[model samples]
Target: MGSGVGMGMGWMWLFWVLLILGVVLLAVVAVRAFGGGVTRSDRGDGRMSQERSRARQVLDERYARGEITTEEYRERLSALGEDR
Candidate 1:
């Protein structure tokens, strides 16, 4: 009787642990679904700024490497709508 009682209590503890884990998992899913799961790249202007900064860096590197002439560099920068 004592052994059987201990076994039952062990299973009961396992059941409660599993139940709590399942609830937490459900809450995370719900939050991601209904809490506006917007990522960094989806923030519009911020992402555009990051892209423009990257473009400017690449352009500067190319110019530094003498891959393009000053005229071409100025044209590309103007096309990108950036003065500097």
Candidate 2:
């Protein structure tokens, strides 16, 4: 009787584990179906935008510090297409 109860409980645990896994799998599929994930191209565009902003910030800082002359700053900004 004791051995039978243990075997039954083991199967019960397995059933619960599989149920949980199925729920998780379903959620993942739903999210993908709903377009809730970022695509590679989207990520690349965001990264490029960030890099451009960082470069602009560095240029601004250098100009403020007199590390670059106004003419040089304007030239660099134009080269970066960031003239403003």
Global lDDT scores for all candidate models:
0.88, 0.88
TM-score of 2: 0.48
Hey, what RMSD does candidate 1 come out at? Answer: 7.5
Summarize candidate 2's per-residue lDDT along 1-76 as a digit string, tens digits.
4556566775898899999999999999999889767776368558877888899999999999999999999999
**Candidate 2 stretches greater than 4 Å from native:** 1-45
Worst ten in a row by lDDT for model 1: 1-10
Over the stretch 22-64, how does candidate 1's per-residue lDDT look in tens digits? Answer: 9999999999899988677668778777888899999999999
TM-score of each: 0.46, 0.48
For model 1, state the Cα shift of residue 69 in Å. Answer: 0.4
